[model samples]
Target: MPEKLPVYRIPDFTPAKALSRGIHVADLQAHRQKHAFVQAPHKHDFYLLLVVRNGQGTHTIDFTLYDVKPGSVFFLTPGQVHAWDLSPETEGTLLFFTPEFYRGNREADALRQFPFFQTWQHPPVFNVQPNSLSPVEQLLHQMQQEYSRAAPFQIDALRAYLELLLIQLARLYPKTTVASEENIWPFQLYQLETLVENHYLEHLPTSFYAHALHLSPKYLNELCKQNLGKTTTDLLQERLILEAKRLLTHSPHLNIAQVAQALGFEDNSYFGRFFKKQAEITPEQFRQKR
Candidate 1:
């Protein structure tokens, strides 16, 4: 087995500090071989997309693992926990950009309107069709050429290409069919979900929200699962783990015990195992490096 590594940020494929402009591009031809180890759950300030050209692997985003095979494509939005488990032989192209790359652009606002940008009970995982891969390949190839352009309009030109790429992917997104109703999709029920996201830290169980929403647990779960693809417990647990990762990676003051208590875990051992089950890394190890 490969030696286990402590949690750490994957080094910038090309050092960010070295770039003079707002964007830089590189073709990560050897990413899979070098990045085979499981990265501790963490988020980034920028956005990235990994296009898998060969091999198969799994990617973890927000506590959900999606199977990735040849021709698969994955997107990482800003500030989402993600890690990859790759075979040593995996090969792909990685695209990275700062938020500025999309800033002040109308398409950026439209792109954010996609449902995948929401807190889905499951991360969006789209299986790439064999035919769709060619456009992605062409986009990457075009992007590589644009990166080396010496023209005065390079930033605007690159942004236009980038917008086109997002538009194509957005078009590919499968639209959810909704049936019209008077109290359609239950707007009030969705308000309850927002309540859960904002205040799950109280460690309130399903009943608590049911009471607040004036609905039975059975009703709430059925409604939430229909729209969000998960039961209330799943959403709560995912949010708890998300916060745990934040505390683990972003905070330096708390040790494992303190962290567990702060997150409402009364038993330290159980908390450790629970975190490992969700994140595939023990809290102590996750906190030590990244």
Candidate 2:
């Protein structure tokens, strides 16, 4: 039987450098291939825009899995855990860029206005119908060709083209208007939920957020339930449990107490009960079986 591949950070890009401003198109695809870049559920502090030209599989992001098909486009923002399970024959153009790329650009910010880019109550999935894909296909082909050309201002040209692509995406997406039926409280709660998920390692209590957001504990709970369908405590517990599971499955060498401490649990016994209650087994036993 083949052994399970250990989950680890995808190797940092080679040419062995970072993209301070922009990257060439071929380098982007080659980086995906060179890193054995079948990413396991992970998050980054940057934006990723992927246009699946030819591929079919599941792409998991932040506790959700999306179906991938030809011409499907997906947007991932910073601090969202995502993974791609693509066919060996998978073909796609994935652009990774910092939020700074779109800094001060109104049209680029407009892309974030869509619900598809938010921490959704439902999964974010889009399938391109035949009649609606010409613009995106045109953009992808143009990006590939422009990237290959040797010109003095090629990087600047790529940036302009990429921004134009983002603008088209904003137009193709449905807009969000502030309707009377929509509650602002839920939006606030979701924003808080994202903060906790992204920084739970800091091991903050609910009061910290309440204080930060200028609200009380009771009000926070109400808002969370209304917006995200979960209470504040429920969201915190879920985040902790998910991280625990990731460590158990990915970091096999770590023992039970080590795992507990890594998750900011000062009381080992309490951590065991908390995990067992959610998982129905003690951590050590859970690790052994899995």
Instruction: Extract clashing residue pairs from model 1.
Output: none
Candidate 2 per-residue lDDT, tens place, 136-191, comes to 76886787787666677666677788778877775665444221345443446555
Predicted structure with the largest TM-score when compared to the true one? 2
Across residues 71-166, which tens digit of lDDT does each residue of candidate 1 receive?
A: 677887665667777776777777766656666455433334433444452245566674777786787778778876667777777787777777
Candidate that scores best on lDDT: 1
Scored by lDDT, model 2 comes in at 0.65
The TM-scores, one per candidate, come to: 0.60, 0.72
What lDDT does each candidate get?
A: 0.67, 0.65
Error of 1 at 51 (Å): 1.1
